[model samples]
Target: MSPTLTFALAGNPNSGKTTLFNSLTGARQHVGNYPGVTVEKREGRLRAAGRDLILVDLPGMYSLTAYCADERAARSFLVEEKPSCVIDVVDAGTLERGLYLTVQLLELGAPVVLALNMMDEVRRRGLSLDTGLLARLLGLPVVATVARLGQGTDDLVRQALEYAKARRGQWKPLELSYGPDVDRALGVMAARIEADRFLTDRFPARWLALKYLEADEDVIVLARGRGPTAAFLEETAARLARHIRETQATYPEAVISDYRYGFIAALLRRGVLQRTASPDRLAVSDTVDRVLTHAVAGPLIMLAVLFCMFQLTFLTSRYPMDWLEAGFGWLGEAAGAALPEGLLKSLVVSGVIAGVGGVLGFVPLICVMFFLLSCLEDLGYTARMAYMLDRVFRAFGLHGASVMPFIISGGIPGGCAVPGVMAARTLRSPKERLATILSAPFMACGAKIPVYLLLIAAFFPEHPGMVMFGITVASWAAALCVAKLWRATVIAGHSTPFLMELPPYRLPTLRGLLIHTGERAWQYIKKAGTIVLAISVVMWAAMTFPGLPPDRLADYDAERAALAAEREALPDDGSAQADRQALGERLDDLDNRQTEEALRRSLAGRLGVALESLSRLAGFDWRVNIALIGGLAAKEVVVSTLGTAYDLGQAEPEAPQALSGRLAADPRFTPAVALALIAFTILYAPCFVTVAVMARETNWKWAAFAVVANTALGFAVAVAVFQIARIW
Candidate 1:
């Protein structure tokens, strides 16, 4: 049987590698955690030349040295799998940085096709390349194309297949000098090493030996000569460190890195024109950053933009939201009237309509947020954010990119700290990554919306947008504080350089956008399908339990008539008309009291009361406490929880005691307390499902940390917001 052609596409981070992967594979790709870890494994197949090409788009990496999580993941695959062909996808515009990875791939001694992606950008910038010379110097076939537009991809794929079928081995990469002493040491080690057999015919054994010379973590895993190997590596690292210190020249890895850059500079100088101006990518980004990332005006603009988004979410969504609520309520009411007052009616009203309606109410919010975020991402402001804010983060020993995930997620209701931590995978250094991961929970996620909305309505009903702004800003503020705290205490490391890629600013793709919007919509729909259905029924049952004994009050009234004659006879004075109005009000008051009292006795209410201990520090009253407990099931349920707790019948409009009105009157929901609740909601633990996803996407340790840290942060921030607001 013919072997499957394995093709590896390697590139620098943010070179549109994943985008290219998605475009190529589409739905053919299957995503999963990489062997016992939350790091995702991306593999797909594309047929070319009547043979299956098993394509593995490796995680974007700065280098093959494995200093970061993504780098390590990529390196492991490259070394272990030894794929049939390696296609190094270099951003044509960012040629210099992208080519560095290309050089590293060639050193692996595999068949290589250099995919020069984004060629249109290069051409548009009035830049020209001698593709022939580049190929001749690199000793490989180089295909220039724009990956995003799907230009030249078919040809690139075909070339990859040709190389794979022929099993071509290209020219060796230019040697990188690690200083004379390092070379001498590598020579001596190579001769003494017995692990040479396994590495032979694969990557250069001498390169493996050279890595031991630099003590590169990526190469040591393939090492042999067991007992002595460990000791040798340790000793080598120590000796190298001493030499780097004594000579003041730096260690071998640093030396080699400089050499590689030097080599690249020389090659570019030979063929590429020297432009006095900056690359268009950077130029475009800098122009925009001047306005968007301005120190004095940026925050104001961000606030203004966010205000518009909030207005869009609430104002634009009202029509649809009302329609959804009314439609669902009518459906439930109709079904209740038609079906018997049993499981079937309950299922339609509570399990299906109520549950789905809750999610549906938030559809506009999700769509608006996702649309804005996608625009922010596409406009290249996200990259600029890194450049602007990373300097501040550096004081806390973290990268600017770490700020991207926080900033993007902070505004959105679904921004869970778990992915915030999972996003830490992009940070190259372990300490910085851990610090960023540890701090991400401070940013509020989407799931906190119900709590935010409920408390905001209860407290600051007039300034919902400002309340949202405060909540959003507060999460980031807390994140910065937490990052600083962790950096000062637990994490100690030198911050890595923040290398950001700013794509040419352009209008977002229409098809790509619809696809993105649809995916987000589907996320809401899918959540409804799973969590909402079950929780709605369960909540309905909780509120309905100990029901009013099927309204036997008529019989009770007949019995009461026999006993009311004496009281009525005494009440027939001139005050009867006023007394009747008073009685009417008293009857309304009694019904409300009865409904609330009965709700408290239900299974859900009892659970909320039990969970109140956890909310007491945050100043959540029993009702708020119950909402929080119910909220764990799904954040949208916080509204539904209020609807349930107030015993507003099966729907929001049916209940005579509007929770919103009650919140307006309640003293416990002061402005400060309301603001505090929003803060807590913004920073608190994600819903149960997000927590599970975080555990799956990252690790159980990270997942558990997200919950513990977020809950603590929420409590602390809420208290601080209340206490400070009271005085200020």
Candidate 2:
């Protein structure tokens, strides 16, 4: 049998590593988690030389130090799995920054190939690269191509296969100039330490010794045993760090990085035929960023952008949203005509039909929201948003990069939470990563959107758009506050300073953007049609009365016919007929009301009632409180619950409003109560899936604490808003 060759793809962020990966594996890739961490594990198999080439795409990172999650996760794989070959993807347009990581990978003793990608961009920027010289300098193969166009990927794979064929058991270690004193110290530490075989070559033994001196968590964990050897190495390392700190102006990493840059500068001077400056888009983007990142204008721009995006989400989606709702109503009517009034009939008309159909109606709105976000992300503008917010995040013990996972996860059930929490791995500190994981769910996720829209329609009828925007902002504000609180009491530390790479603004990749949008939209569709569909069916069944039999049918038919007749006879002022139609609809709604009242007496409604009653202690009524409780399992349930409740609530439909409209107008739904309900939903913990992810990502203990803290925080925030609003 042919031997299986393992290939690793490593690169800095925005270096086209992922694009190259897709070209290599097509749709054959599978995503999993690294055994104990939440970092995404991307693996795929490619056919080469009649043998399977297993390809692994490591997280985009600048280094392999185990300080943060991605670096640690990627470093672990490289050391343990020991891939047969490493393919280092680099940006041809920004070779210097990209090569920094490539140099580190080479230092690991892995057989490395440089895939200098984005060649088209390099040419457009008037840059000429001598691939041959670069290859010689790095002592490796170099392939130049545009990954997005699938140009050089085949060559890359071919070379990787060829390189693996001639692999040997031993490779040389990285040689560096840390000056005579530091070199001597490293040699002593390495000689004194005994550790895992994998560690011996993949990392500089001297480098490990240095971090051990500073008491790096990863180093200490890896060097747990070999008591005498470990202790001697650690004590000496600690002494070395103190001496360096007292004598030097910078830490070891900074010093080493400066040297690497200095070396690269000299190499560039020697290798280049001509050093020509090309006009680049970097100027335009930087000019724009200057204003957008201004302390004053930056926040204002963020708010304005958010407001406009939300405004577009609602306004643009309205037509399709209404069309979907009407389609569902028509389906319900069709079932009413075709089937007799029985269990099967009620289940079809109200339970299965109303439940499933109602949830599906929200798809258009969700797609619009996600579509906009996908575009923003694809254009690379989303990363800049994090940089703009860094100062604020740093104050809460988080770096700018920690925002991506949090922002992404706030969109749907089982959203980017795993990735977001894993994203915290980029931070150089464990405490910062854990803190990011703890506070990630406070952003109003897409799951909560349906509920917000429903309640806003039901409770703030005067301005639906404005209400939705307010709730979204509230979610963000609550997240900011919760993160700060977590930092102060739970995670307990300041975040390490960090830097973010800002990609030049380029036209978004249409294919990538559409695929991402579709993926997100598909998740929403599945949830609305399946998870919420089942929940809605259950709620519908509970809302149906004690008995749906012979006696009820006769009275139901009689009232329905009579109400229809009354609506027809109303004065022809148009609205009169509408009111009449509404009255007849109310007759149809009666059966749902019967079941709802019974459930209120039974197990489920009693639960909602109990929750509502508790909420009343915070100045909410039965209806607003019911939304609060029903929203626990799924925020969107608030809409379905209200719709069902209205189906069960007095059905006397008046004029042109939806069921939500009437609920809002009722005397019981005061502005304070409405605002309070919004506040609660915005700050409350996300549903089971999100909590489960948190538990799995940060451990159950922290996840459980997240739930408890949010529960209390939500109530406190809600009540405070209610009292304050009422007084005003």
Candidate 3:
């Protein structure tokens, strides 16, 4: 039997590493988190050359440094797992920067096969590479690949298998000279490390010595645990560091970095790299950036882009949203006709169809927004957005990097707060990170997108595009203001400089776009069918139980009977037809009032009524209160809860109307109330999952602070809006 081999796929971000892994493993993949860390772990299995192979897709990292989360995760995996071979995916166009990580991987002593990706981009740029010479120089097999097109991937895999078969369980850490000063110090420490076998099982002695010189905190701690010998190594590192700092005006890390680059530059000089012209001047991406990233035009273009996106979202989604509404209304009517009128019928129509279906109705809008956003992201415009906003962000005490977190959280309107909060991990400053986390949830995440759209459609139906754009702007303004507040008070710190690489824009592949869009759409559908379904059922029960008190029911019944009797007393003539119609209208009004009263007596209703004293200041009736309360679980649930509440609270005459129509018809829901509701929903506390994620990312105290502070602020703003709008 052939041995099963394991290989780790590694690369810097945007190197096409993920595309390569997907091609290799296809659908055979499992994704989870690394133990005790939030970094995702992706693994898959493949069979090639009659040998079974396990491919682990490591986190995208610039280098195996122990400073950041991704770097630590990548380094830990290499040191601990010690896979059979490493397939380092290198972006061909950005070889200089890509090779930095490659050097670190080689030094780690893992047997390596280089997958030189994006060869098309290189060719397009009029650049050529001597692959064979590059492979020989690096002492590894280099397979030129266009991972996106799946070109040369099979060959890359074959070479990886060959290397894995040969290097199984054995490694010889590569050594590079860092000039005489560092080399001499490294040799002495290496000898000490070898003698004591300090972390030798997990790390090579020479590598450990290099890490110590680099002042890697993780490595130093491990070395310290080795006891007395660790002291000698530390003292040696200190002496060499002081000597180098005095003579060269630099530190050990710089010394090591300089030599590594020197090695790469020397290797590239050896008939390997050939260029026709200066790479940047001839590149199309640069030409586009000249205009799109202009000082004056950039921000304006961004705003226009935002306006267009919302316009497109609203314009394209209207027909589909209406179709969905009609479909759900039909389903509700069908359920009502089929089932006997009672709790069961109510459960099917109001609880399930009206609640979950209401959320599902917005899937088209969410999908369109997601597709557009994904296009912007894949086109590399999002990075430019961050770049253009760096100065503004810094002025507000946020790192420009916070831009991504905010965008991911729903800075674009159709995003989620969970990943948004998670993205804050990229921030180095604890103060900035906490502030970003707190402010990120204020963005119009995808969950809130439906709530915003629903309300905008209900109240500001005449100018949905502008209204949506206004809500988006409001969200951004609120986030920045709140971040400034946090910066000034609790988590105050000077802003840090932000740096990012903007990948060249390319036409997105149809397959990839469809797959991305479909996945997101399916998630929305699945959530409605599952989590939302359960919550809707529970909310339904809360609003259903403890039926109207006997005395109140009898009073409604008596009034209904008297109206029937009066209608029956009318003469059987054309003149009496008008009287009969009037009496029927009176009866419907009676039923609607009775249903409203019954709902108020239910559990959810009672809670809403209890909070009405304060909530009403914001123009929220008890029904809106219930929905807002449900929104704490998830923002989209606000839509679903509203659907359920209105369905149960209205009379049969309004049964066929959509939630929007129902709200529009209700005297309690004026345009001003709708705007105030929108304000509150936009600024309220994040969903339960996001709050929990915030706690996991930061601490429970901050999470608690976020909830209390945001809700209070949101309510205050809502009440102020309501009061001001009422006067208007």
Q: Which is the leading candidate under lDDT?
A: 3
**Range of the 10 consecutive residues with the lowest summed lDDT in candidate 1:** 649-658
List model 3 lDDT by residue over 257-357, tens digit each.
Answer: 99999998898899888987675566888889999999999999999999999899889988998888888888888888999978998899899999998
* Tens digit per residue, CA lDDT, model 1, 85-162: 788888777888888887777665667888888776666566787777888887778887777799878988887888
Tell me the TM-score of each prediction against the true structure: 0.85, 0.86, 0.96
- The TM-score of candidate 2 is 0.86
Of the two candidates 1 and 2, the one with more favorable lDDT, higher being better, is 2
Looking at model 1, the pairs that clash are: 413-445, 413-446, 414-446, 415-445, 415-446
Write the residue-wise lDDT of candidate 2 on 1-728 in tens digits: 98788888998888889888888898888999887877889999889768898899999887766556777788889877888888998877677788777766765677888898888766655567888887777677898988888997878888877877777534444665666556677777776543433256445675566556446678677676746667777677666666677789556556567766776666567673233455444545567788877889987987777677777887888899888777777777777678875667666765555555545677887787887787777776777778877887887667777777667766222244445555565666667777777767766677777666766655665766676667666665677778787778867886677788887666777787778878988987777777777777777665654434566557766776777777667887765766877786686676556554544653445566777756775676554555556566676676666665555453322212354565666777677876777787766776777778778766898878877888888899888888888899
Report the lDDT of model 2 for residue 13.
Answer: 88
Q: What local lDDT score does residue 594 receive in model 3, on the 0 to 100 scale?
A: 91
Q: Flag the better candidate by TM-score, 1 or 2.
A: 2
Stretches off by above 4 angstroms in model 1 are 168-188, 194-203, 218-248, 272-282, 290-319, 322-326, 329-356, 396-398, 411-414, 454-461, 486-504, 546-591, 610-619, 648-673, 693-709, 716-728
lDDT of 2: 0.70
